[model samples]
Target: MNFRRLFAVMLKEMRQMRRDRITLAMIVGIPVMQLVLFGYAINLNLRGLSAGIADQAGTAGARALVMDMVATGVIAPTQTVNTPQELMASLRRGEISVGVVIPPDFERRRIDGREAVQVLVDGSDTVVQSAAVQLAQMPLDNSVALANATGAREVTARQIAVVSFYNPERRSAVNIVPGLIGVILTMTMVLFTGVSIVRERERGNMELLIATPVSRSELMIGKVLPYVGIGLVQTTLVLLLGLWLFKVPVRGSVLDVYVAALLLIVANLTLGLMISTKAQSQFQAMQMSFFVFLPSILLSGFMFPFAGMPRVIQWLAEVLPLTHFLRLIRGVMLRGAGLPELWPDVAALIAFTAVMMTLAISRFRKRLD
Candidate 1:
């Protein structure tokens, strides 16, 4: 090893490395992003979850229990409903994550040494379910906290019946298998659509497309529309496999799932069209897809708690279509939720599809540049 030759080669490599700004940025940026997201955004000690309370008990003791729940920063009251049915309605609307249904005889039963209260937890997100279950008992664990806060005798958290509504058994497969539908769709749809235009350009098909009477909007839509059927077949196969192999049940309305699934599929297909327009070559298209794909995997609540992330990170995730679809997939498979309960996710996906379709049509170039 000659010292001079080694130093000269190192200097030449350094100059090339300096010009590769994207690689340098990714090297530094990816790690920093992982650190920040894993540290600040992934919170295990979740607290202050928004909850709806139906204090049918309507007694000083019931009110005190609510206060204790709030003070512990475990379950913050978002709204108070008069009946348990109303509370369930609030939950289905995604208005709240936790529901407390205190029976009218809660106080009487507590004094009589019997179960009197129930906690309904939204089990769509496994992380939220776990935290909510742990905190549902605070009123019982720290009964002393409410000793002076109310006139009725305090009860133990054990007496509080914690019912995880969606994925009741808290099975890992139950939560993950449904979510995989969205993740897999995002990856395949985006990969195919992203490279479609680039592949056409490379094959000299752009000239043929330009000579055709089809407008840019029609052309783009035609390219992506077929994926809708493919997505349906994939969704059915995956769901059937999950049911048979993993014993993951679709407790929700299957019709609702299919409808929502169709909308979600179209939205993602349009997103791929938009990516196709931006990428000039297959390599560039894949690079762009990874930029979207990696974040979708990390921030979409597919792997972590959407509610557990910091407010800003959660807001950032709103732009990713996968984030919304995960909720729909999970809600359908577990919550047995109908369209009324899933309107927000549907609305978001619709908005995404509309915006991306418009953008793709407008940007789609006719020339092979």
Candidate 2:
């Protein structure tokens, strides 16, 4: 047995690993990053969901009912509207998660043991819908006080009328399929383009590319353009399978979905190019892509409720391209939202593409370093 030789080889490998700082850092960084994200960022128990109040009753009792709901910690009333239509409009635009509509005949309905408040929920998100449903079943603590104020001895058992919009059936596929597009594109587009330049350098094509008249911008665009078509094809396949197997309906215009998908594809490709520029080898590029992929899947509302995350984590998630794309795809396919309702997300994707493309181009050099 060659114990001395084995020890010498082990020491040599350790020194080589030390020199490859990126690989060494990733070995430690990936696990720590996952632990922090799963512990602090991923939350299933949703709280403080944004809500709008349509207080047609406009009375002390109506206001008291709102306070009682707020005390449940299920929702935070962030906006007041004149009508249920306005409240629903806000929900359609993804501005609020829950809507409270106090009817004009609130006191009569309460005293007569009829339906009183209408709780409108955005049911596209299963977690938020489940919470809203629970809120509906809960008896408000202030109902007794309001009953006494109206000279009624007892309050009706059913005070809130809960209605779930945008997937009343609450199918998981409706939510998952749309977000799946983003996740798939992020994984493939980033990995494909991430290795492109590195593979060229490894295969000795860099000298040939440098000798050509191709500018850095031209090279970057050329690398990603083919992948854009590939991404759209993948998106189509996913959507078709979702519709055929799961019966997930595309309620909005298909063109809008494609537009969002295109922006996401380009953004991810540019991000990959940026990674390729920084990475010294194909292995390092793949590692970086995996790093980006983990956060995009976990923190981008693909697996968890976006509203459930803490405020700071939500703010950090806003920086990811998949976060905005998920909103756009889900809003279009599930909520029947269009350009008017989803312009903010579209703008965000465009801005992300611009920033990533600029960084990728600036960092990429025409010559081998």
The TM-score measured for candidate 1 stands at 0.88
TM-score of candidate 2 versus the correct structure, residues matched by position: 0.97
- On TM-score, the leading prediction is 2
**TM-scores, each model vs. reference:** 0.88, 0.97
Report lDDT (CA) for all predictions: 0.80, 0.90
Off by over 4 Å in 2: none
What's the distance in Å from true for residue 46, model 1? Answer: 1.9
Cα RMSD, each candidate: 3.1, 1.2
Q: By summed lDDT, which 10 consecutive residues of candidate 2 come out lowest?
A: 149-158
lDDT of 2 by residue, 13-90 (tens): 999999998888899999898998999998888889999999999888888888888998999989999999999889
